[model samples]
Structures are given as structure tokens and as C-alpha cells.
Target chain A: MQTTQRPAVSEAVAKSRKKRELIKNVVAYSFIAPNFVGFAVFTLVPMVMAVALAFLSWDGSTNNPITFVGIQNFIDLFQDAKFRQALINTVAYAVITVPLTMAASLGLAILLNQQIRARNFFRTMMFFPYVASMVAVTAVWNMLFNPAMGPVNMILSGLGVENLPRWSVDNNWFICMGTVILFSIWKFMGYYMIIYLAGLQGVNPDLYEAAALDGASPWQRFWYVTLPQLRPTTFFVTVMLTIQCFKVYDIFLMITNFGPGGKTRVLVGNIYEAAFTSRKFGYSSAIAMVLFVLVLIVTLVQFRGEKSMNE
Target chain B: MKEKSGITGGRIAVYVILILLSVLTIIPFAWMLSASLKLNKDVFAWPMEWIPSNPQWANYINIWTKIPLLKYIGNTAILTVVVTLLQLLTSSFAAYAFAKLRFWGRNLLFLGYIATIAMPWQVYMVPQFMMMSGMGLNDKLIAMVCLQAFSAFGVFLMKQFYDGIPDELCEAARIDGLSEYGIWAKIMLPLSKPSLATLTIFTFVNTWNDFLGPLLYLHTDSKKTLQLGLRMFIGQYSAEYGLIMAASVVALIPVLIVFLALQKYFVQGIASSGLKG
Candidate 1:
């Protein structure tokens, strides 16, 4: 009788434990359900569909049936001149803009981090362009850089410069792409500056003090102490900036209009033109896959580099 | 004496550079403000009229009548408020589960979010368009709301903050007969004011300034948002710089006000979360 009772008590305990576990899962899932349902339906499902759609052909017409095309879209993408030009233009923009923005923002961060008067005011001023509407910002930029009547040209003329390069209007890809790059750097540097400022705050003062005690100059101290300390922040910034550079669309569209005979056209612009304007949804998805792979490679490479640096 | 002089010279050089860059940064905004007050013809007058002799207050008034500006503003305001509130509610709820709850498959579920966050939305936007259209949500403000509301970034940011709050507090609250939901609402939400403000500013500003999402989703005039409205205004009145600037100013005012009021939280939010705003 005693043995049977002991087993019965143990069985009851086990059943209750399972019941509690079930209840816990139900509650936990309930907490995440509101967001997860929406996320799964919109983001996750679409992502899987995007991968499949890249291998299919659809013109985004109601009447056109979706059909599997194998790797034909990708094959066509590589052989397409417009896509090749776009890929090159995008790489050019990223290569030129990313490093310049990084260096400028880092320099600004180091400068502002010093014990300077009106630091907050300066920082706020720098960050103002970032918060402003891109439409408005682009409008003002087009006006300012307008060759015919822009103040920049007016000032340059005053300086006796004859060739006021047709900045936004110039059919020359360099002039057009260069102007967009300049604006991109100006508009976004402040954002990265703030991130760098946060990184600066985390750097221990003792390292700087020790470097100074060893009679290190300001530049030397920065190179040896400040930079090494800010490695993680720099890594984060590079990954973010690289991904952002790949996704450049609005500024290109608004500023260049992919103009000068499609010279300033980037990969995203190519995708937009294909998907929306031409309604070739499958081809667009294929281009998007290329974009995805490029972004993935850059990010993975950065992460690998970061791991090696840590070791 | 030499060190003192060198330090003073360096400080002066810093100030000079700072002032120069500040002027370059503020020039566009200043030009916008000045141009918004001028006549269309006078907007690009040579040598630049930094100040108009007589400000055309009518540009501001005319912008309202130009293209259903009031309707656009109303649409934007509604989207901003609704999206921000929904994101706050859902993200914090999801984050609480991720951070505090010891549930099965927690890490795996959260991994899905982190992975997707890294993937560009453009990569999947075609399928998303099809899915939304199939669901009969395309060309509807509800589509934008559905797409933007459940942000993984919001959940990630909130979870980062929630992870910092000690689990012992939740355990103590549970002992006091409070349920998990009660602990999230009564204990967690109250302590997360700063993070809430951060998320609020982020969602508000992004929703407000968003051009791409609305461009793709909203095509109807009545459904159009401020960014799209502003673009249409530009297309129609390409030469009316003053009126365009006025419309742009009107569109930007709310975001500016929100940013200014919550400026401290905005800076602190970015710093603490290390988010790419």
C-alpha cells in the first residue's frame, strides 16, 4: 500500500510539471503572437517567395501566368548592358562614398569629442540635414547647384572660373555622379558622427593619459589609443555603411533621375525600373537576388574581418 | 609658454573649421526658409536674396490650395500616429517574451527576426507586392500600416533595453501574484520610458518622411502621403520654387517639432541602442 501511494504521488508531480510547461509556452507565444503573425505574413513569407520568384518568369500582369524559367533571368542579367552599367555605377558610388564618409565622420567625431565650447550646438547643426526631408533637401540641392543661376555658380563666376561644370545637369557621368556623392556624404556624415561620438565616449581616458605621459603627440595618441579602442564601433559603422551604400535609390532617383543616359543608374534603380515601370517582376527579383548576394558577401566579409581582428 | 600658444592655436583652428562646416550644413535649410517666404520669380535672384525685401506670406497660404495639401498632411499625421503606437505595443510585447520568458524555441524564433532584419526589404518587395495585392491590401493605407507596423528593429531595440532590466524584478513580481503580462505592463513598461521615447521618435520620423513605401503602395491622390504629395507638387509646378519650398516647409514642420521636443531622447536612443537611424 505504501509503495503504491508513493508512485501515485510521483505521477501527480510529473503530470503537473508538464501542465505548467504547456501553460508557459502558451503564455509566451501569446506575448509574441501579435508581432510574429504580422512579421511572418509580411516579411518571412515574402522572403521565401522572393527566392522562388527569382527562378520564375512573371510580367506582373493578371493575365500572364507565372512560369518557371530556371536560371535564365540571372543569365540574361549578366549579359544585359544596362544591368552591367548599373552594377558598375553602384560599385563606384559605394567605393568612393563609403570611405570618404567614414573618414569625415570619424574626424568630426574626434573633433567634437574634445572639450570644446558649444559642442552640442555644433553637433546639432551637423545632424540637421539628416532629419530634413530628402525631397526638400534634394530640391534645395538642385537649386544651389543649378549651373545657370545657382549661388554656387554665381560665387564661382565671381572667382573668375569659366567652366562652372553643369553639376546636376551635366551629361558627364562623373560630374553627375560626383555631385550626388558629395550630397550623400554631406547629408549622412552627421549620423555616423553621432555613432562615432558614442564610441568615443566608451574609450577609456587612462589610455590617452598614458600615451600623453609617454610623450605621444595628439595624432600618435589618436592612432595608437583612440582608434584601437573604437574598433567595434568602426566595424559596426562599416557594415551599416556598406549595406546602405548598396541600397542607394532615393537620392539617385531624386537627384540624377538616372540621367545622363542612365550613367548614374544604380542596381536598386535597375530593379525599380524593371519591376515597376516595365512590370517584369521575375527579372527584377533576379536583379534583387544579385543585390542580396552582394550585400551578404560584403556583410559576411566584414564579419570575418572583425573576427580575425579580435583574435 | 610654447605649449600654451600651441594649444590656443589648435583651439582657434578647431573653432574655425567647426564654424565653416556649420555654415555649409545650415545653408540649405536657411535657403529653404528664405525661399519659402519669397515670390516664385525672386527665388533664384542672382547673388542670392538671403532675406526678401517683403516676404510673400501668400506662398504659405497658397500651398494649402495648390494640391489638397491639408488632406496629405492629415493622411501623414494619421499614418505616423497609428504606426508609431502599433510598433510600440507589438515590439515591446514581443521583446518581453524574448528577453524575460524562458519558453521553448525562443532563440530560434528570435533568430528569424535578426536574420530578416539584415536582408534588404527591396530584395523581397516584389513578392511582398504580390502578396499584398493578392490580399486586396494594395493601394490602401492599411497595407503600409501592416507592412511598417511590425518592425523587427523595434523588437530588437526594445529587447536590448529589456535585457538590461534584471530578471529578479520579474521573478519578484510573479511571487506577488502578478502574471507575466502584468509584469510586462506594470513593471517593465513603466521603467522603459526612455526607450519608449526613442522608439516613438524613430517610428514617427521614419513614417513621416517615408517616400518609397508610399510611392509603391499608394497611388490614389486621396491616399497619397506628404512625400508623394510633395513630389507631385514638384512635378506640376517645377518652376514655382517659392511655393514648392513652402509646401516642403509645411510637410517638414511636424517632424521638426517632434524631433526638437524629443531631441535628448533621440540622441540618447541612438547612443544606447547603436541603431542606424
Candidate 2:
């Protein structure tokens, strides 16, 4: 009788444990439901719709239905001159802005990491532009870049320079692009400097002492010891800056208003115009798809690089 | 004595360079403030008045009168507060499930969510705009609030914070017969104040400075946020540098205050998330 009761009691315990596990699952699901549902409705669904809409021709009007035209939108995008220009402009912006900003911020970080006075104040001053709104920053920059009456040109002309290009108004793409790049560097350098500062903290002081004992000059120490140690941080900054550079819309929109006849038009600006201004939903999605692919490739490369670095 | 002199010289050079750069960094803001107080005609004066002789304090007042500055500020405030609170609640709840709960497809769901961060908004901008308009939510602050409230980045941030916490506490609480929601509210939320504060600072600053989101969603003049209002203000009063600078300065105050007050958390939040990425 005792042996029979033991098996029955064990069975009852297992069943109760199963019931508890089921209840726990329900509670977990309930905790996740609210956020997950909102994310699905807003982000996940829209992403899927974007991919689908890229292949269809739609005017975004309810009177017309989305018609599937495979590969045509992509083909047309390649053939479009404006799209080509935008792609080139965006690449140029990233190419110029990324390395310059990185070098500038890394330089600032190295200086601040020294036994300097008023370090915190310097850091705050550098970061102030980043904290300010893009609209406000660009507004100030726009006035500074004002062709005739702006202080920037005034300073140049005061210094007896010949023929100041109308800064942002210059039809020459290079000058306009340069203005945008300058503003981008000014706006973002502080934020990147903070990242480098954090990276600097992780470097062991003993390594510096060892280098000093080996009769390394400050320049050599930076070149040999500091730069190598900052590889991971540099890589992270490069990836982030690259991604951000590709999505450079707000500055262009506010600073130059597409820069004196679309000379500085970027991929995002193109996509904005196509979708909202021109009402070509399908075509705009195709441009966005190209952007999506470019970003995806960059991100995947970074991940692969990170994995190999880890190995 | 030679080494000491060399070190002193190097230090002096560093200070000079730093001071110079700091001046360059600050001059734009200084110029903005100075120009905001100057007469419209004096704004472009060459050797530009670093200091306005007669500060036009009325430019500040004029900006208020020219546009519905108060209305825009109110709109921005409402969106920032609502969105920040909702994001914290939703992100923390989802983060608790991801960090503490046992579930199927958890890792897969999280990967899907995090992957969205890599995609720029341009990818889904049109579709999301269409979705919002279809629901007749376009031009409404609540729509913007709802759209921004569930950030995958916020979830990822909170989850990283939650991952630092030991499971022993949650297990102990469970043994004490506390429900999962009770554990989340009473145990997890209380302990994760630092992460919450970091997320709050980031969300508030991002929302306050946001231009594209407001530009896309809120079309009506009365519904515009501060960023959008400033943009339109520039377009209309492009010639009025004094008023523009004053408006810009006014628009920048809240973010500046937040940054100054919470400098440590703000910098830490940026560094940690950035390095992790």
C-alpha cells in the first residue's frame, strides 16, 4: 500500500509543476504583449510593406491600385540622372565627413585626456552644438554662410581674399558640399570625442609608463601605443559615422534647402521628394531599397569585421 | 630643470591650442546670442559686433508675437513627456520578459527587433506615413507619440541594463509568491533607475530636437513642434536675423538645461550605447 501511494503522490507533484510552468508562460506573454504589439504595428509591418511596395507601381491615391512591375523600378533608378547624382553626393559626403570628423574628435580626445586645466569645460563647449537642435544649428550656420552680409564671407573679404564663392549658394557642387561637410564636422565632433574619451579610459596607464621607459617620445607613444589600443573604438566610430553620413538629410534640408538647385541633393532628399513631392510611392520605395541595401552591406561588413577582430 | 621647462612649454602649447579651438567652437553660439540682441541692420556688420551696444531684448518678445511660440512649445512638451513615459514603461516591460522570463522564440524576436535599428527611417517612411494617414492620425501629436513610444533601441537598452541584474533576486521574489508584473514593478524597476534615467535623457533630447518626424506628421500650423516652428520661422523671416537668432536661442533652452543638469548620465548613455554598437 505504501509503494502504490508513493507513485500516485509523485504523479500529482509532476502534474502541478506542469501547471505552474504553463501559468508562467502566460504571464511572460502578457508582459511582452503590449510593446511587441506596438512594435509590430508600427515598425515591423511598415518594413514589410516598404519591401512589397518597392516592386509595385502606386501613385499613393486610393483611386489607383498598386500594380506589380518587377525590376522596372530598379532599372529606372539606375537610368535616372538625378538618382545617380544623389548617390554620388551621398558617397562624397560620407567619404569626406567620416575621416575628418574621426581625426578631429580623436585629436580633441587625446588633448582632453592630458593633465590639462578646465578639461570639463572644454569638453562641454565642444559638445554644446550637438546638444542644440539641428534646426537651430543650421539656422546659425545659414546666417554665417550668408553670401554677402554673413560674417564668414565678411571675414574672408576683410582678409583681402579674391572672389569669395557664395558659400552655400555656389553652383559649384564642391563648395556647397564643403559647407555641408564643415557644418557636419562642427556639429558632431564633440559627440565622437566623448566616445574616444571613454575608449581612452580603457587603456592601461602602465603601458604608457612602459613606453616611457623604452624612451618613446610623446608622438611615438601616440603612434605606436595609443593608436593600436584604440582600434576597437576607432572601428566602432567608423561604422557609426558611416551609417550616419548616409542618412544626412536634416542638415541638407535646413542648411542649404537642397543647395542652390539640387547640387547637394542626397539619397534621402531624393527619396523625400519622390514620395511626398512627386507622389511616386513605388519609385521612392525603390530608391529606399537601394539605400537599405547599401546600409545593410556596410552593417554586415562591420559585424564580420567585429567577429574577425574578436577571433 | 631642462625637463621641467620642456614639460611646461608643452603644457602651454596644449592650452593655447585648446583655448583656440574652444573659442572657435563657442563663437557660433556667441555670435547667435550677440546677433539676437542687435538691430536687424547691424546683424551683418563686418568685423561683426562681438557685443551688441544696445541689446534688443524685444527681439525675444517679437518672436513670441510673430508666431505661436507658446503653442509650439506646448505641443513639443506634451509629445516629449508622453512618449518618454510610454517608452520607459513599454521598454522595461518587454525588457523584463526578454531578460527574466522563459519563453519560446525569444532570441529570434529580439534579433528581429534589433535589426530594425540598422534600417534608416527612409526605408519605411512612406509606408508608415501612409499607415498613419489611413488611420487619420496624421497632423496629430498623439500619433507622433504613439509612433515613437515603442522603440526597439529602447528595448535593447533596457535589456542590456536588465542583463546586468542577477536572476537570483527574481527567483527569490518568485519563491515569495510575487507575480511577474509585481516583480517587474516592485523589484526590477526600482533597481534600474540609472538605466531609466539614461533612457529618459536620450528620449527627451531626441524628441525635443527631432525635425523630420514632426515635419512628416504634423502639417497644421497649430500642431507644429518647436523644431518645425523654428524651421518655418527661418523660411518666413529669413531676413530678420535678430528675430531668427532669438527664436533659435529660445528653442535651444530646454535641451541645454537637460544636458547641463544630467551631464553624467547623458554622456554615459551615449558612450555605452555607441561603443556597444
Candidate 3:
């Protein structure tokens, strides 16, 4: 802002604004240099490398012959039973969890936005699960879902609901979805609720005041005014959540770790097993490519949706 | 007067529900705390013991002796601090450039930054592993440290904060002879403290909780992060409830403290940034 004095700030500093612009350009490049380089190597470049590796057949072993087997690995995924299970579970996981998670967070944000006493206390309580190491927190969740000693089954029995479906039990499709969905909500509701709360607060109270003058009931005001005003925030949230649910690994890896006949398995889980367990780096890259393609499609749809809304 | 009383009644209902829901949310940890203090067998008694029989505080001490609890704590603290400092510096500079100092490729690069969000880290893990392995930095903490040191998400947040500072304030500084970098470090940064504090807290919390990067990169126990260090406690000598809970509780304190202390900024930061499309 003080650039005006620079009309004569220094002997070397004098010149047209273009000269000054060039100086600023160099400075800005230095500032963002590390980040662009990091993104290129770790993100952009590795992705391209992964794409190239997809067609190569090698087990990452010294003696294994490498061959360019175009379309073979992609074809293999169609017949791979484990890959099918992982794909199905990933789809089911997102379908069940994302909507439920968003709804719960939105509800909690509304409740918390009210003039409740000890609001900060409630906020902290809700956000506690989100602040810990996922492994540690999921270990607790693991015990909670344990068939033998977990509190869930214990609570079920206390209510005389005997013969409860075993959570974390192998091949129990319903229970796998249930446990992962519950854990996913508990893990993230705080963070998202915080986001929703901000959105709720951003909504001008003037609208509420106007509705009150018109004799609108609280529920009517909320449904008519608050909900419509929060659409933009909701759209941003939906996009972010969709991407996150797709990439979810830490919690999935920790709780059940693709458990019980691989019923809870996800694409990332399959990739981990392929690369680390089987030492098939090329195959893992192919799985990653599939995941990349899926995410690309999902994000592009959201971008298109956003553009249509803007228009 | 009837309407006033009805409003009062509704407020009371809200309070009761909020408190009840809060308890349901927090009860698991309370149960964890209770179980952590109980003797091994007391954990599974059918009727259940809500509190520990003896309140064995030594469970906290036992985790230290039985597991590498102290080493894990040290590793987590160092990693959290180092990464937070680096991200704040790198992010702030880039964000300032994006927010105020315009140049060529600026808008395009920002779009590229936003686009990185969709390419989940797994898509690049194989290639990242290749590069780090090539550099011989795989086993070292550098692998984890460098991966996170400059983040696109961090830049996204910092740029938002910078956008809020009036351009006139910056122009005034420029008229007074401040360099673009100097204006950022001086006028802009001090004004952007609230957002910087939020970024600092999140970077620390996320880094501390991060399990994937440390899991992928660090192999040796001595070099292990707290998350990896904590993973060791689960299976060793059966699932001892007391020791594991002790370690888990201890592990949560730092992040919890960090969150509580700077909470106002964290909430405000998210609120501002969460402003939608």
C-alpha cells in the first residue's frame, strides 16, 4: 500500500509500474514455488506416473518380467472378485453415510445455534471425537463394535434384544454398513456441524426479524427463510463431503480394516492390500487409476451442478 | 402473555434435549475413562460396572512401562509443531500473493490448487512412493514432513483470509514505500492474525491425528510417530483395556488443549471459509 512513496523510494526502485510489476512477479513466484513443486512431484506428476504404471505387468519383484499389457489390468478388475467386493462396499458406504452425516450435522447445527445455555460446552463435547488420532479413536470404536464385549451388543442385550447382529463380524453386509456409517458420522459430525453452524450464523438475523413481524411461526421461518438462505453453504458442503467420503481411508483402515469377507472393503483398502500385502505395485496403480477416474467423474458433476446453479 | 409462556416452554425443551444429546455423544469417552481405570476382568462383568472398582490410576503408568508411550508423545509433539510452522509460513506467503499481488498465471494456478482437492492422495501414493524411494527419503521423517509442508488446502484458507483485508489498506502501505513482501509480512499478516491462528490450530490437530502418512513412511519404532506408536499398544499382550485407555487419554490431551485454547478463532475461521458457492 505504501508503494506511492516508492516514486522515489530508492535509486534502483525508480521505473515504470511494469518494472515494479516484474519485481512483484518474481517475488510471488518465490513465494508459491515450493507449493507448486510439491504439488507437481507428490500430486500431479505421481498421478501421471501411476497412470503409466497401470498397463505395466510387474509384481515389484526383482526377477519378475515387466510387460506392457494394455487394457489387461482394467479388464482384470471386472473379473476380480475382491475388487468387485471393494467397489460395491465403497459405493454402499458413500450412499448410506453421506446423506445421513449431512442431515445429522445440519440438525445439530440448528439446535446448537439456539440460545442454549452452556453452548460452548455442548460444542466441545460434540467435537471431541474429531480431535483425536483416528487409530486411537477407532480402537475405541472397534471395542464398541466387538461382538463379545462391546457396549453396543451389551446395550442391545440389556433391552432384551437378544441374538443381536454381530458388528465387525465377517460377511455381515448390514452390520458392516451400519458400523462404518455410525463411525463415519461420529468421526466427522463435529467438523461439518461447525461448518453448518457458521452458515446458519452467516444468515442475516434481519430475515428472521422480518418473518417474525409477518407472524411467521418459528418452524415456518426456518423452513421458508433459513433453509433457502443456507443453500449455497449446503452446496459447498455437499461437494466437499462427496469428495471426502470417496477418499476416506484412515477411519476405514482403522475400524475393521476391510473386515469380514472384505464386506467393508473400499477402493483405497484394495489398493493398500495390492501394493503392500501382495507387493503388486503395477496392479495397485491400476486400482488407483480406477479410483481417480471415479473421483474425477463425481467432482466434474458437482462442478457442472455449481455452474448451472450460478447461471 | 400466553405466547411468551409457550416460548419459555420451548426453550426449556431445547435445553433438555441438548443436554441429553450431549451426554449420548460424550458417554463413549466417559465409558472409556471408566473402563480404563477398571481391572482387566471388571471390564466385561455382564451387569457392567459404571465405575472402576479400585480407580487404578496406575493404568496411566503401566502404559508407559508396557508401551513406548513417552516416545510416541515426543514424536507427535515434534511433528505437529514442525509441520504447523512450515505450513503457516508457506501458506501465508502464497495466500498473500494470490489475495493482493496480481501477476501472470495467478488465476490459473489458483484453479489448479482447487483442482488438487479431488485427486485423493491414494491416486498418487504409488508415484509419491516412487519419488521418495528414489530420493532415499522414504524411511526418514522428511517423507512425511515434506508431503505436508506446503498444502493446497492451507493456501485456499489463507487466501480467503487475505481477501478480507481491504485493498486500500494495502495500497496505503504501498504508497508509503513498502515492498509487496514487506506489506504482507507487516500490514497484512498482523491484520490476518485470527485466520493464521485458526490455520495453526488445524495444522497441529490434523498433523497429530494423521495416521496415513506416518503409516506409509515411517517403519522403525524409534522413528515412529505417536499414531503409529499408539498402534503398537493395541495387540501387545492381549487388549488390555486399562493401559490402552490410559495411552489414548494421554494422546488426546495435547490436541484437545490446542483446540480449546484457540477455539474462537477455529470456529470463526471455518465459519468464514465455509461461505458457499
Best-fitting candidate, scored by DockQ: 2
Q: Model 2, range B1-277, lDDT digits (tens) per residue?
A: 9999999999999999999999999888998999999888999887767888888999999998899999999999999999999999999999999999988778888998889987787778888999988999988898888688989989989998899999999999989999888999999999998889889988999899989999899989999999999899889878899999999999989998988888888788878777888
Q: Please report, in order, the local distance difference test score of every candidate based on alpha carbons.
A: 0.90, 0.90, 0.81
TM-score of chain B of 1: 0.97
Ranking by lDDT: 2, 1, 3
Off by over 4 Å in 1: A309-311, B275-277
Q: On residues A32-114, what C-alpha lDDT tens digit does candidate 3 reach at each position?
A: 88667776676677777899888887776557787899988889888999998888877778888888889888888999998
How do all the candidates rank in terms of TM-score, highest first?
1, 2, 3
What digit string (tens of lDDT, one per residue) describes model 1 on residues A1-311? 99889989999999999999999999999999999999999999998898898899998788879999999999999999999999998889999999999999999998899899999989988987788888888988988888898888889899999988899779788999999999999999988999999999999999988999999999999899999898888888888888888989999988888887787889989888899999888899999998999988987877687789769
- Expressed as tens digits, the lDDT of each residue in B1-277 for candidate 3 is 9999998999998888888888878877887787788777776667777876688898877888887777877877887788889889888888888888878999999998888765788787866886788788877877887877777888899888788788999899889998887897888788888989989988988888887788888898878888888876675654687677777788778887888899888888777776643
- TM per candidate comes to 0.98, 0.97, 0.92
Model 3, position A180: C-alpha lDDT score: 79
The sequence of per-residue lDDT tens digits that candidate 1 reaches over residues B202-269 is 99988998988898899999999999999988988889999988888887788788887887888888
Fnat of all models, as shown: 0.69, 0.77, 0.68
Comparing 1 with 2 on TM-score, the higher-scoring candidate is 1
Show where candidate 2 strays beyond 4 Å: A1-14
